[model samples]
Target chain A: MSEATEQNGKHFPEKQLWGREGFRDDPYIEAESLEVAGDAPAVILPLAAWLGLDDDVRRTSNRRIGVFVAPGESIDPLLDKLDTVPLIALQFPAFNDGRSYSKAEILKGRHGFKGELRAVGDVLVDQVVFMLRAGFDTLEVTNPVALKRLSASDLRDTPGYYQPGRGSAKTAGGFSWRRTPAA
Target chain B: MYRYDEFDHAFVAARVEQFKDQVERRLSGELTEDQFKPLRLMNGVYLQLHAYMLRVAVPYGTLSGRQMRKLGHIARTYDRGYGHFTTRQNIQYNWPALADIPKILDELAEVEMHAMQTSGNCIRNVTADHFSGVAADEVADPRPFAEILRQWSSLHPEFSYLPRKFKIAVTGAEHDRAAIQTHDIGLHLKKNEAGELGFAVYVGGGQGRTPMVAKKIRDFLPAEDLLSYTTAIVRVYNLHGRRDNKYKARIKILVHETGVEELTRQIEAEWQALKESDLKLPQGDIDAIMTYFRPPVLPERPEGWGALAAAKKADAGFAAWVDQNVTPHKNPDYGVVTISLKPIGGIPGDASAEQMELVADIAEKYSQDEIRVSHEQNLVLPHVALADLHAVYELLLADGLATANAGLITDIIACPGLDYCALANARSIPVAQRISERFGAAERQAEIGELKIKISGCINACGHHHVGHIGILGVEKKGEELYQITLGGSADEITTVGEITGRGFSSEEVVDAIEKIVDTYLGLRTSKEENFLAAYRRVGAAPFKEALYGPVSRAA
Candidate 1:
């Protein structure tokens, strides 16, 4: 039995780890999955493998692919394949390395990537706040405390943000627009 | 002195609660030391050699009378009844239990202060010109922008986990008292030919094992682009800065390796993309922040020169104090009074609870309730009236706060070297104290004339030895403490790194070596008017080398 995590109000089994694995055997998305892998469905590929895939194969692939990006790793080669891929799982390697945050921002804000942006590896309770603001809606955290914190409804209770984002106040990346009295 | 609104209040209160939880988890052994180290550092809790030292941010070095009083309270109630003012313009309580940090942070939050971002890999405290609002030669007050940065960088979600620590400094004066050139990002607030406000953006200047002066990336960046431009620069650094080696991970190394032009091009591209984003500060927001930092308006008062002159004549001690401790304010009737924390044979920058309260009381009574902590490890009452100087001095003297050595040779800047730091190779305070006592006489200091001696325990340069007029760096040699001296460094507008003398001296020999170097300067100087830095610059290092190591040939 597989466990499911919440995403956009839907539960999806997180069977896709960042490696050269065979696609998930799903009945509903066979046509989409078979485009590139010819019958294997929902395959997850590491950055190198994804880059090695032929351009024509990647362009013709109707299946939603997943690619993992490490901290300080350039994602320029993957930009052209972003439209075909449905998930971009950026790796944190270490919680201290923050390159993933900028990677997410470039994917979402600059490249207009509408796919699911996920943060993987060393996802702790503290970094979830930053990850969400940087446009990572899906998280793969192994820490039990962090997972519990993520599911709690009060996770967003911290007051006014300084970064302006996709939504208005009270949403991710929103800032308080309060004005002060005259000095 | 930006007062907290509902948002600021809620933000800090929530942060306190979150930290309380973190502390609980750490104490419960749920989080390992490695897991908790970064979190503790981000909150300015350091596990030093002896105990956990909590550093509290004093934003832009400005504090209210009430805030200063609260600091005194924390010192008396929690740690030892004293606090050390750091060169970063913050305060460190040398002794605090890990369990008490959350409570200390809670106490700090009541006064709109916290230790958040004081350490760790995030943007640290945004330091500015200590004489900001009342400076005689300022284009604009830099505190407002500093406050803006403080808010934006506080708990900034994205840039929190940088490859290395980031520091930003701002200056509004041409004198560069804030030492902007040695920071990761230096902003010079200025007016263009049209008299419109803007910033001259400097990037990648820093001091540590490797010291580099910041380069001017943009000669004139519009005031409105402050946030966007800063964000762009950090983002570029975040994506590309080296992470393989901790020592070379600083943005300066990145700037050096990538070349400034390429870095600037990347930053410009990032800024262009962010210009239309919400990171751009609207005019109203700038005005709102700026209003909080406007100097209090004062009516013209009598010059009171005759009364001051009479007081000076009556007491020679008061006259010396006035001559060294008082600075001219932009307003003719007002004065900026520097309360020296470096007293004879005393630990530099450590003020007892009583001393803190006494200064707070003086600020409330005579300086419009405003106080500043300079990067030189001293406090300032920036708006004291010239007529009230005598009264302020009397109170300071009583509380042991009046040392009358603001910029003199005895006013040494020393880090809490091996005494408290985990990284220090040798002790700095004892050396600083010995030098202070050696040159403690008011007459001797007056003769030396504006010499700065800064000491760092190690090459991390926390003591700012790189820019000190006379810099001393302590190193461990053969498992013993060794001191290396450098000469002619200045953090002023003309920034220069110091040059190391031939050999390192033992701890016992360091003080005598310093005396010989000063004697060389005194002998070579043409007149009393030529200070140590000037004479050293003119004569170069030859005379000082000969004096310290016998002869130029033997010196090498």
Candidate 2:
């Protein structure tokens, strides 16, 4: 039931969040009270709280449901419910703690999750490229340097990548040594 | 040597521009030191004791004369007129200004080189046998596969931020000159029953505060499955490796905690999904890379044999140099020459800017313009013809690069200890100098035979002390520096970590202790042919221990 501010105690409002379509109003809000699934139109609850919901409530609710997963938290419990969840936000508690990168890959590449994958907390400019490549479709940036770079579209990266990632076909082709230029 | 194509050029250029922008932001105070530390590390810049140390990658230990000249230019222009070649087959400049790094990187890119992934928690420069293609005993060339790994591991997003750094080594010979078993992942290139090239894979081997030999995970992995299998292993490690403690973060620790059986199972499971993905290497791509490493055509220089024999007869120094520093090449007319960097009483692994340029000139005129940096802190001309030996020897002799100690006792490997490294607890170079001078007599060294003495200033084992025939570890005890010795360690086909021999010795007492061990070995050895390691393995540490600490007390 903790409010979803920046995990590192930084103040990044919902407006600072970015997605594929650029900055927009965030429709989903973190459920403040997990006791009863509140009345928010779209609520993002902790993984345990979302899993604790009644089968009927989870399956038949009219409100959109998302889940926030912390680092080291297994995604096995949500495997069967991937279809019902519209978003899965992974926390980076610290930029160097890369446990969330593995979770994101598991969700997108292993489980074939089609929902939005967002990276939240401690997101910095240097890690943005890696986050994107690790299947993060959105980022909740809090660092001022990262925010400036993101706004200016100054995310510098090499033209080609050495490893295949989610949606790699549209961006690159063939083996890494002889990769075709990204479209 | 692998040449950079247009795509490679663009890739390095993009990285240069990116780093340039990052440096600008750091200078403008937009990024704090904490934020910029990792960024600089990714580009191979480290904040050392006094100044920044820049480590430039020499992929697979292969370099052209032009590239070597550029490295010399970098040393002369930016650094203090010298550079240190590291055990990982890369060159490190000890002093460089933070602001001037961008310009240095730009210059490196011009020679198809950069410092990407040289540090940080990413995959480091892939090393191979210095005598890769020319080694007479090689099953196949390892450089092409090494180059393939280099390209794949570079800028790999999923693995850029791992629990700790990863190192991969490849060797094509049965002799294991690349020290495969001491690497995180060792690939031994060999042919199968049907004569198809593949690799015997070993994983989790490392040397540090805790040194462990890598266990064989797979008997043989097909060449096409190289990338997929490697991806699977790294992915498994990235996901499950311990994050709470940095010391236990390496894949070796995970291999220990998870047990090899379970770790192998996990790696296999992860690899199953990726094996059929785009990670599978195409035959054409591998062949294309192999095309770049094709041995340069050398015309038969049969007359050099007669000239070499005459030169040897005339000059005993030249004879000793040829007898020690030269190895058989794949081509009978050619010989693999190891130019020793360890002069008597000189710092190990250090080469002056002028010496580098001279080596480059020698490599160009005689060695088919190819040069290689050995992990043992030496330069190699892998394809020198026998006919050119006298000329090459004369050139090297004049420049003090012709030290006749290839695998002899005086050919020591020592890391930059308290002298330059911030992490070092004691000095390594001075000890190496003392040991080198103590055994400087050519006849004495030749009589003692091959003895490797690797020294590290700390437990990090940057000097590969764990694998030394006689390993020396420097630690700060109380307020004084103490040196500990280990015996019978080797980094060869039969790899074993050295065992510590009783208590440590003070700096003054260390060289004498080493001399005592050598004298004991000479006394008890089965024959002169028995090297220090073979003799130690046979006699065990009992004799060396008794020689140092005296026989066990019967009263106890």
Candidate 3:
């Protein structure tokens, strides 16, 4: 892997995901002053006290956290998070996956999220163009594969297809028909 | 039949323009491949084994002849001159290029259609009974609610990025024709004693690796709270669904891990919070949507409808086709004709360009210009005149679409398996064909009686195998195809997850095992008329298991 992942210690390999539930009582994870995106349970401050975040406000910092983009994932949550982060990396569970692509596009084009939009996981050389089109300026190519040697130009290839679908279907098969002005 | 309102029209236009800009940006190398993948998928586009598959939602399986013709135009002009109707009641054009999708979407939009959310983890195309409006057993048409769900879910700000793909299906009949129990969220419409409409909501049902029948979260929910209650369920799932492991990300997993009772409590809490919000469905809004879906002006009972007896006597082929394809209509003079998209020896859900045009013409002529795609890999002309059944039958016969096997063993439901699907472990079509050929005999299918055979290439259960009376799941073992057979699952109100009896079957022996099970049911059934599902339920899987694993020698 690149210098980014010199060793798997004290850090996630590519991205750190903070779902509703996360690693608790783990030495690697700090238990204090964590900020949740869009959703939080009742009594977070109290939980902080319960977990002893009361003594340490700095524990939540330095623990790099990120947002998620899934198939039919709402774009607004990620958009709201973009305003505060310098780099927002998207994870594609599978290579042929499409949901995260929409998130990247909305983040860049619509929400104006130009700060490092990274593509992580199942990131293949061939799919580089799709990743580029979806507005992921940075790519965390899995395992520092052969594609790591690609120049900036190579990763930024033109993605074919002209349809507008990002942030469109909020759900699966949740499509709408668009009428174009006749030529 | 639900026409697009201005809001819907405006939303699609904005989305189209947005995609156009994205495509332009991609072509200019302004973005990288990593950035563009999800954008394409949200547009109902996918890069598959052969070509880019563009899946267009046929909302609730309802389509007008005009829309069908528009689909045909796109197929003939942009694609390989045909589209495959998916099990979710959506039509997929398998050969569209990535470059042409926007233009295609534009064309679709002109016809009040778009390919949004045809893929991805979002709430997918809401599916309903193909015979929704015209079914004799229906108390209410599920299309309006499906449309409402479509609107509420479309580009919904809070739910675009979910843990995984979410699917919902609706059925309004006492007889569950829409396979509602097998969806991530399923709803059944029933009337209360006070003549008020309500829904019976089922949650957490899914057909992936862990095939499950959704538990009833609420037996009867008031109609006004449908949207709000559903929003509560999805929100609860979004907040609590597991994201650490992809396999366990589905709401089914959440419901399973949390226990349905507590999940129900959480949903109740969420609903209680949103009980009085704008999310609460208003009577006027429901009426407005429902108004667009009322029955067509049908003719009075015709003499030829009763004269069908004479016609059957005169034409045996017509009789067979009628017996298989025609369903009793609420209007006694009419019938809903299920056009079998599962033509024998053909792909289970595909339609040729010619078939589309022909169906379009047939729809305009005899079926009130209405067409529906059933989740079971078939099409329905929801308003066919009973007197014109012969005419429809003749045209269908010429096109090789006259398969008289709806709900019979030969009418197998199959997913696009290893041949095209990237996720499939083995091929599912050939198995479906083998079974179809084995049960192709009219006499054999007639003897077997009302068997639902659903096959999935993998555990995703895209074929709804879990709820099938006989579910065949294809998996790879030692680099060879091994089929696992599960028996006695029902997708109806009494939904039961099928149980695997024993060892997996080879591709060659899979159909034979199905054969053995059917034979046992036939032998043990009290009446020749007792269908496979009824017999399996009455006698349980012991008899079928014995028939499949080979009879345990009685030690005589």
Scored by TM-score, the top model is 2
Better of 2 and 3 by lDDT: 2
Stretches of candidate 2 exceeding 4 Å from the true structure: A1-11, A32-37, A167-170, A179-183, B552-556
Q: What share of the true interface contacts does each candidate keep?
A: 0.69, 0.59, 0.00
TM-score against truth, every candidate: 0.94, 0.97, 0.78
At residue B501, what lDDT does model 1 achieve? 82
Candidates' C-alpha lDDT? 0.84, 0.89, 0.74
Residues B1-556 of candidate 3 have per-residue lDDT tens digits of 7887655676687778767766776778865666676767777877777777889988898888888888889899998888888888999888887778889889988999988888876788899988888888889998888888887777554455677889999999989988888888999998999989999999988878887778899989999898779978887776578766778988999999999999999899878866886566667777777877878999875875677878888998889989988989999888889898777666898888788888889999999899988888788898887778888989999998898988888788889898888889989999988888777888878877898889999998888788889999999999999999888888887888888878888988888888888878878898977777777778776776667665773311
What TM-scores result for chain A when each predicted structure is judged separately against the true chain A? 0.70, 0.86, 0.47
Error of 3 at B481 (Å): 0.9
Q: Candidate 2: deviation at residue A103, Å? A: 2.7
Per-residue lDDT of candidate 1, residues B1-556 (tens digit): 5888877788888988888888998999998888889989989999999998899999999998989999999999998999999998999999988898898888888999999899999999999999999989988999989988988888787899898999999999888999998989999999999998999999998888998888889999989999999999999999988889989999999999999999999999999999988778888888888777777987675665666888999999999998999888999888899999998999999999888998889889899999999999999999887788888889999888889999999899999999999999999999999999999988888988999999999999888888889999999999999999999999887888999888899999999999999988988899999999998889898888888887635655
DockQ-derived CAPRI band for the predicted complex in model 3: incorrect
Tens-place lDDT per residue, model 1, A62-156, is 65556766675689888876777777778877789899988888898788998777777777878767777777767665666775665553353
Best by lDDT: 2
